[model samples]
Target: MRKILIVGAGQSGLHLALGLRAHGYAVTLMSNRTPDEIRNGRVMSTQVMFHTALQHERDLGLGFWESQTPRLEGLGISVADPGHGRAVDWLGRLDHYAQSVDQRVKMAAWMETFAQRGGQLVIHGCAVSDIDYFADSYDLVLVAAGRGELVSMFGRDPARCAYGTPQRALAVAYVHGAEPRPEHPGVDAVRCNLVPGVGELFVIPALTVGGRADILFWEGVPGGPLDVFHGVTDPDDHLAVVLQLMEQFTPWEYARVLNVELTDPGGVLAGRFVPTVRRPVASLPGGGLALGVADVVVANDPVTGQGANSAAKCAAVYLEAILARGERPFDAEWMHATFEAYWEQARHVTKWTNTLLGPVPEHVERLFGAAGRLPQVADRIANGFDDPADFEDYFYDPERTDAYLARAAAASAWPGVRGARRIRGA
Candidate 1:
């Protein structure tokens, strides 16, 4: 039996563990804290899993969505020009696209499934030290530690990479039951609003085990006097600025939940703005001859809300590669190629999303401007999420854009109007 040791009990770690065990591997999962402790203490982050990623979960028979996730019908996106206090709504829905799942719940589900599969899970904290790979102590050591010390092994040299300026600071707070304000009436769940120069804010409905509704505010802080808001020590004061900015930037309906309180007192829910960066994959001293599987190798910005989905997708791919090699000697070349394949698949999507969130590029701005004037164009953009390949298709293939744009233009024309003629004449 192949013995696999997984470090960190986060979503990625748990997913990989359950996957390996199901394949008949002997898996031992270790984490620093007990499951209950991690569940109760950790602050929940907003995670939106796309349809493709969900399919992977279902194929793995994880059954996470049957009970835990909130099915979201569509996305409500608003673009605002804060300086002029002008905002426009760009609404789109997918028949079967994405769902919001509580990170904590997802983690718990994976852990439970891993255990039921006869996988050994150890709660004792174990710090991994540098080791000789040829020693037959273990078959694989996978690291899924997020933002932990183990990441140092794969860390990149800062001097070699070109990093962009930090766009905006993000402050997230999980609050319970501040009723949706009038502007945000009948708000069933997730909403994203752009505050122009100020930044973008997302309000997502959270699913907690207690059935109490939770609110997550992802506020973007652009440079200037607004930068001071980043330093405010008081949560109330910080929240006030968020509300004021929202009210000024857009005609958003938001209810102030007077009774709502934060889950954390010290404001551990916050994280600062950081440029999105990816470290090139490095081959660890492992071939099938060596005992140790590569752990978490990818780190992405949460701006696109693809972190969880990407992690899950990568896990699935990695699982396939492992199963393919079977008991054969682990070929270092093949393992590196497997990692690169997943990275190549994910890079385009990540870049497209980051570009969208960063200062709107001219081409994108023009595209949106046209989309606003042309409903058909808007539909194509909206349906972009439904495309199986998503941004990947749009980014990697220049030809695909033209085809998509043509379809968009055609769809945008008002009923009875010839879109081809309209574009030809213009």
Candidate 2:
């Protein structure tokens, strides 16, 4: 049996570990925290998995909280108009529903599942030297940890990296008592509020440890007014800061969060990370190579909310590569090939995400406005979250954007499907 050591038990690591186990390979999963520690810890991320990623989880029988999590049936984008509330607002129904289960609840449950399935679970804080020492003991060592000393083992690929600094100052708070969008009434949707030149506010429906909740996340442009969550430690203070920002920049969203309270004292996360793409194969001190997976290799800003989705896809890709290799040595060449296969899909995500982090392009901005008038346009954009490759067709180029819009407009003219003009005009 091939023995594999997977360091870092996030979405990718754990998924790959359990996957290899199901194939009868010997797998050892290493995590810095225990199940209880993770479950009882501060909220990790704002994740809403689209159909493809969620299907991958269900394929592995890892969708334990599927029924409990809110079914996000659609996605709405509201571009804030200075002091005037929303300038362009519309909701696009997704072809398939998306769902978000708090990482604290999901990861903890996954860790326990891996152990219960007989995979070796090691609770240890790993470092470069530690991976070097254990490199010879396993047939493969995959680094899924996107932070700490392990990430440094993989050098940064300057050509692949777009930004040298953090793009957005991120702050997330999970809370309850938030009302649904008045426009969409009983429909649950992910609300994305774009404040030109400032940042964005994303309200995601999720299931946390405390039950059904909402994640009010802010992606603030650095040095901007929204970039003020630096030293707020108290949960109430954190919640207060979040609300104040909402009240100021996105008052419409604030109306929905009026009586919201933290799901738990540990339901807040505030931090920032430079979006990076590191070399896939990391050279260990002891002459063994560790392959980087997911965010470790292609970390993009969460502005597009692709972290967890990308991680799930990476794990699936790596599992396929590993299974195909059979008894072949998992060498540096194989590592690069595996990541490249994944990158073919991930590069689309990286490009789309990086594009959103900067100033919105004229054509793209025009596309957003069109989405409000054309339901087909809005639905295409909404479902693109499931397969971002669709964006490459018309997202960047002005000619292609215009062509696609014409096509969507023509399609909307078909009988029984006239596009809804949903934007609220000032």
For 26-107, candidate 2 gives per-residue lDDT tens digits of 9999899999999999998889899999999999999998888899999999998877488899998898899999999989
Candidate 1 regions off by >4 Å?
Answer: 65-68, 83-86, 130-135, 157-167, 178-189, 212-214, 219-268, 273-296, 372-376, 379-389, 392-407, 413-426
* lDDT by residue (tens digit), candidate 1, 233-274: 677766566555545554443445445566554322555534
Q: How many clashes in each structure?
A: 16, 0
Summing lDDT over every window of 10 consecutive residues in candidate 1, give the lowest-scoring window: 417-426
User: In order, what is each prediction's RMSD in angstroms?
Assistant: 5.0, 3.1
- Whole-structure CA lDDT of model 2: 0.91
Each model's TM-score? 0.80, 0.97
Task: List candidate 2 segments past 4 Å from native.
Answer: 416-426
